[model samples]
Every structure is written in C-alpha cells, then in structure tokens.
Target: MKRRLALTAIALAVGAAASLSACSPGTASGTELVVTTFGGEWQKNFTDAVVKPFEKENNVTVKQVTLYSSDALAQLQAQKSSPQMDVVFFSGGQETVAAKDGLLAPIDPAALTNAPDLISQATAGLAGGRGPVVQITPMGLLYRTDKVSEPTSWNDPFNPDYRQHVAFTDLSNSYGTLGMLMINQARGGTIDNVTPGIDAIGQSTRAGDAIITKTSSDLQQAFAARDIWMAPYSQDYAETLRKAGQPVGFAIPKEGTTGSFITANLVAGRSNTELATKFIDYALSAGAQEKFVTGMAYSPVNTKAVVPADMQSKILAGPTLEKLVRFDPEQITGNAAAWQKQWQEQITR
Candidate 1:
C-alpha cells in the first residue's frame, strides 16, 4: 500500500539543497503533504516508522523537506507568510522558540489517539501543551572501547588517565549544554548553580587535559581519529558510530543523563492541518516509537512503546535510568543564549 516516492528521504545535509527552492503548500484534496524532517539515519527511521505508513493509509504522496532542527525553524520563520512547510520536527529549544514566535498551531489533544500513551514528562514545555514527542535522545558519556576503560561516572571525562585526550562539545550546542547540566546535577549543583560543573571543567581546561570540539561532527571525528577517548554526548550517535565499526561504547554515567526532545509541530495555517496533526500523532504512537527505539536507538517518550530484549541495555531502561535527569525546555531555551555567552567567556577560554 505504500506508494513509493522518488525521494523517500532527503539528505540535504544543511544547505546542500539551497539550489532547490521551497514550493507552494499542499491543497485540500490531500494530493501532497509537505513535511520537514532532519536527515541521516533519523530521517530514514522516521520514514520507515511513520511517513511511509501515513502515506499508505492516507493515499497521498509526501514531499519531504529535509532540514536540520535549527534550520527548520529559521526556514519556517522566513517563509511564514507563504507557508511552504506544513509540519516540522524541531529540537526542544527550537520548539520553544517556534512556540513563542507563534509559528506553531495548538494541537487538540482529542485528535491524537496516542496522546495518552506518552510518558508524563514528554508533554512538558510543548508549544501548545500537547503533541507527539518525535524522539528522546539522551546525552551521556561515550568512550573509546579500545583505548578508555568504560567510564563509570560523569566525572570520568576529567580523570587524569585520559588527560588531553578527552573531547567536550562546545556549550553552544544543545547536547553540549545538556552535558553541562548532567555534570551540574552530578556535582550537586542545581540548574541555577552550575558553577560546580563549570569549575570542574575549568580544572581540566587549565590543566591542558581536554580537547574542545566546536560541533557534534568534530567530536565524532575526534573519536574516529582516536584523538579523544571519552565525551559527554548522545548515546544514539555513539551507537551509530559503533554500528559503523568505530571502537566506541556508550553509558549513562552513575550521575545519570539529560536529554533533548525532538518534537513534531503542526504549522499554524497550512491547508493540510488535519493531515499534519495526524502525522504528529503517528510519530508518538507506540508502533512508531518502538520502531525509532529498536531501529534508530533513540529513547521512547511513549510509555506503551516496548523495547526489544536486545535493545534493553542501550536505552534508559533500568531504575537508574528511569530517574535520568530531564531539563525544563522553557528554562533551558530562555537561558541557553545567556549560558552560551558565559560559556564563550569562561569555559571555552
């Protein structure tokens, strides 16, 4: 029943497709639905878990506009009047921004049959109070299985044994910022008091024991080249690297991990509002969530979504992980810019 499209998943990879311009919004006949998604494995997993199924069920062709989370919001804002994008997937902080800018429409909880399946916290800080949380990829510690003893604590990245070979993402990025939050909580500092985490990193920075990475790709490259033995980062990304034959391993350090939520939002005034909402609901459904976790190694926000025995150890499954740290998107989004400023002035120095 799934009708194949020429471009099932587009890997525009951050402006690779600037040569292509945005199109007009979909019509009332539901002939096509324009949706924006992030590329790479996440896009592929989403296509399999949700997009293809939605297409088959609705009998409409989907035109995917692949954009990074940050770029997706920027595009939406740029094209607000013309409304080329029907729905979008955004990282938590971006979602908060989109919500604040009035870019997202309110999702009627009644329409989302799978709404009740979400874990209590997944609904936090959403643009309209409720919708499908696309995926929860928690930030933790990833280490070189061959060169570093698996890190057992959040502080392991700073341990002198791996001195000068530890990678830390610059705090400008979400995962990097979330990593700091994990360290903050682990070191007995509240969100308001992150100086403990800052001071800890300063010790390593001043001692010349850390390698600062400007982007996620930089961190990955550092790991691949064996220049960094450990980092506080995404578990799924680490899994992706390991599956690609990198000698990497991931763990939720004893202090626990924090996560960034990817959310699907219904655009305010696209003609396909109903279909768009259905797509959002589908992403959070048990079937879709299960697929994302099993197929993509992303954490599930749905309580009913079951993890296969084989993937149990890879997710936030145990009691310890069940208590993993979660950030307030509103608080984080509101303060992230200021934090980035401080990070530039203090940590990155």
Candidate 2:
C-alpha cells in the first residue's frame, strides 16, 4: 500500500580496469558512485541479487545513498549548479519532473548491449522524456490468499463485510494513487478526476473501514499479521513474501491497475558518464534481470530475459498483465500539487 524505501550499501575493491579508467583524463580518482533508491526488502534484494554480482564482475566499489525520491529530488535541485549524486533511481513520474527541471542527463541507449532487447513499452515510456525516469517494475495489488477470495475486480475491496479490514497506503504515493485511480476507472470514473474515489475513501475512513498506512513495510507487516484483509501493494513485495512461504497473492484488477516505469538519471555535468553507463548496463543485464525476478519476483523490462517459473504462473500471468493501465505522466506531473492537496484533504485526514 504505502511506498516503502529500501537502501543497500555495497563495498567492493575497484578492479584495475575501473581504477585505470577512473584515473583517465577527465575522470575523478576514487569517486564513489552514489546511487539513490527507496529503502526496505527491495534494497536487500537489490544488493544480494544485483549489486554483489556487479561489484564482483566489475571489481568496483559502490556506495549507496538511500532517501525518499522527493528528498533526493530536492537535494538534486538545491545543488543543481554542482550536483552531488552520480546516479539516481526514482519513480518514472519524478524522473520526468526532474528531467523537465534540467536535473538529469540524457542516456544513450545504444551504449547498453541489452538496450535493444528491452521491452518496447519500457523504452518508449522513458524515451523523449527530458528526465532519466523510466519504468522499472509494473504495479499491482498484494493480498493475503488466506483472507481473500479470488478477486475479479478492484471493487472487491469495497465489500461492506471487508470494510475496516481493508488497509491502503497514503494517497501521495504515485503507486497508491494509481491504485485508487484504477478503482475509480473501474467504477466508470476518469483518470483526471479522482473526486469520486476520494469521496469513497472519505466515506470509508469516516466509517472506520479504511486503514491508511504511511509505509509499504507497515502495510506488508499488517497484511502478514492479518491485521487487514487486503491492500494495494507492490508487485515486488508480494512476490518476495510469497516466495518466503507467506500465504499472499498479487493481481491487477479487471478495471486495470496503474503502473509506472523507473529510470536512472545522471546528474548534470557529472564526470562519470562512462561509469554511469556501465552501471546502467549492468543493472539491466540478463543476469541481473534473472536475479531480480528470482530474488525479488519483479518482471524484467528486458525482453530477452526469461521470467522465473514460479512467478510466471502467479503475478506474471496474461490476465493480470493485461490489466495494467498506463497513465499520461506529463498530465500527472503538471497537476501533482493539486492532486496532493486533494489526497491530503480527502484520504489522509
């Protein structure tokens, strides 16, 4: 439900190749690649599944800085004239906003060997955007299989009997907001207009039927403890839990679930362009994709990579995949302030 942040710090000895490359003409000596990301299980998964392998393969040390996307964006904005971070990973929408604000450098897809194999939608979603934000994972819902019947629609969460048992994340979360938007759309509401869903959530909150949490870990813990019957959750979390033998399942409703792509951006005027490119390539590699799916249960954006068998039958099924609803990031970015205000007033209070 709530967007959780996960941070992983990996330290590896720099390979001679990397060291020599760093010492080259324009590169800084012994520079730490500060990669930013949300903190929690995903961070651990990333380190175990991706970072460790990359560090070993490249023989380079990486220092990770973890913070909420908004905070990172603010820091980047404040230091625009002299950027502090070398690489950043944030929500697709935030990436677009940062790109528009001139905080990111354009990525050269051709530089990545796996770039051509990436899903067309994934590339198209991030291409032509000023920022480095690209969709990293598709969004969906996570629920306790023991407590829920097979859900055919998003409206199932609104069942009167399940009232107070339904936990949801804060509305300010792009993913959570999109979940709400999906519910609205299923009920015949517009994406640009969330008033109907806001009113619905307001009524639920008033009746003490809706539980709002501030973090994804909190929501996951609540669900794991059976404190709530269902909540909109990240595909990554649901997969991780289920793999751990928890009785959880994930789905995208018939009305369609809202999804976003995540992208990494280079800080303006940074001298580590080559290193950044290598990092990106490593992150999107087939081996990395396999580890991501096997360890995190997320679908890889790389088309050539095979999805794990367990997940292929669960969250990666066709029906669930087809229900993913893509939104116009430009419009959402333009109206973010207004949306936040409405969410605070109607859902958070």
Candidate 3:
C-alpha cells in the first residue's frame, strides 16, 4: 500500500511538470518579448489579428511599445550596450541603418518556415547579402474622384496649375521622402549625392503648389476634407478611406510609382535569441501574412496567400502593381541626412 501511494504521487508530479513545460512562454518559459512599432489603428489591427492569436497559441505575451521610427532608432541606438527591445518593425532605410550599426541580427531564410511562400521581390528586397532588412510595400498616388476628372500622372503635381492644391507629407517623413525620390526618378534624376530631387520638390512647395504634413493620418484628414486633389499615399490608408465611403482612387502614374518596404528586425543585445527568431518566423508566417492582408488591408509579402477579390481588383490591378519602382534602401539610407538638410534649406525655407 505504501509503495503504491508513493508511485501515484510521483506520477502526479511528473504530469504537473509536463503541463507546466507545455505552458511555458515562447521566449524560454517566463521571459516576455518587447516589440516596438508604430502606434494607432495599425497597431490595434496587428494586436487583434496577429499578436493576440500568437500569444494564445504560444503561451507567450508580447509587451508592445509605441514610438516613431526616428525616436525608436534613437532608443535602440542608446541601448546597444543593454538592449531593451527584442524585436523592431521599421522602414527599409532604418533597418539598413540598424544592420550597418550592428544593432540587428541577420535572418536565416532557411530557418523561416514560410520563407518559401514570399514573393521573389519581397525576398530579394529584404534579404540581401546582409540578410533581410525590409518587407515591401507597393506605393502609388491617391486622388479624390469628386474633384479630378482624369487620373493625374506622376509629374502632374509639378505642373503650375495643380501646384498649390497638391498635398503630401513632409519630405523628412518616410512616405514624403519616397514620393520625392519617385518624382526625381521620373524626372530622370537620382537621390544619391544629387539635390535635384530636393530642389524640385522644394521649388514646388515655395511656389505654393504643394502642402506638407507630418503624418499620414493628417494627410488622410486633408483628403477627407477635400482640401487637396491628389498626393503620394499608402495603399492601406487609401483603402481605409475608401472603406469609410470616401470617393478616393489610387493610380500608378505613367513613369511608375515608388514602393516602400518595412521590416521587423531582431534587436542587438536581446538574450532570447531563439525566441526572437521564433517571433519573427511566426510574424512572417503564411497565417500572419494573410491576417495582414485581410485585417490590416496591407498587401501580403507571401505569394501563397490569396488576396481578397475586391482588394485585388481595386488596389492591385492593372499596370500599377506591375510598374511600381522598388526603392533601394541602401541608397536611401546613405543619403537620408543630406536629403533632409537640403529639404529644410531649399523647400521649407
């Protein structure tokens, strides 16, 4: 009887241990992952769709911190000796800067289960010799249908008549910088060691043709108010406005629009290397990609994920998607500071 009782107690103990092990958090049982990203509606969507589901399934909680890209970069740079963030979601140029500064870990494509499903462009754009830095965003122009009779070309805002009515985010901002670069490219210029791009946009602004805002939300507000006819905008924002019954239309100009790629990178000094990789793998998974498209209205990087019919027809259709000019992060990051200096001096002045 004594032996049997002892055996039963041991069995119970073993079972409890196994149960606890199964419930351990993704980053080695008790450790929580610190994820940094842009806050607001997009963050909410990500939490609802990806973060919550991931936490439940993996038995791990994500502690998300909100910060602008520049501020986040500053924080990360400051903490290089004792990194606080486990993962970071930022623009291609920022990712390149982080990687160059040795603040990021190189991602192994072979280790990612869903890496196979990603499109060639996405993979190529993100993972170069230094490893993946960005997840690509196909960009184009957004216009108000009620005001404009025909689609405006990429260079249309450069015209004198439409100058004052054109609204764009500040060139210091990511989208604005991209828009400026695209215009420069269309005008047969380059952003590398050249101020023509900055000069042109600045001249337009000085001439009372262009309006600049700090955030995409502000740009959307202007569009909603019908204060501006058209500007370079994000597909996701344009979709959000359209869903709210706004008469906004997206177009890819004849010279081709610029595409922005954002990436989630591993922090430099985080101790949970295995867990960080797991989180990145899960985020880039096919399921997560599908959620990004369906819930957030952003295009999926995974080619295997099927985009909704309506979204595909409305946003990804025609020559627009085909003609999108993918921006080079290396070039952009190399010149970002100089561009900003020129922009302040020429355009804002």
Residues 223-262, model 2: lDDT tens digits: 7674787777677767667666678777766656666556
Screening candidate 3 with a backbone cut-off below 3 angstroms (N, C-alpha, C), the clashing residue pairs are 126-132, 163-209, 164-209
Once fitted onto the true fold, the runs of candidate 1 whose alpha carbons sit more than 4 angstroms away are 1-29, 124-127, 318-322
Candidate 2's C-alpha runs over 4 A off are 1-31, 129-135, 243-245, 317-323
Error of 1 at 284 (Å): 2.0
14, model 3: CA deviation in Å?
25
**Could you tally the backbone clashes for each prediction?**
0, 14, 3
TM-score of 2: 0.84
| TM-scores, one per candidate | 0.84, 0.84, 0.83
- Model 1 C-alpha lDDT per residue in residues 1-349, reported as the tens digit of each score: 1333324334344345543322334333356778887777777888999889989998887788888877888887987766677788877567766777777787877788886777755665453543446687888898888988778888888777889888777776778888888887888988877777777776677678986787767877888774788888897888787787778888777766778777788777677888888888878888988998888888887888889998887777424334656677678767777777766666646
Residue range 249-318, candidate 3, lDDT tens digits: 8776777676666677777656666777777777777677767776666666666666777667455522
RMSD for each model, in Å, please?
Answer: 9.4, 10.6, 6.0
Residue pairs with backbone atoms closer than 3 Å in model 1 (clashes): none
Residue 223 in candidate 2, Cα distance off native in Å: 1.7
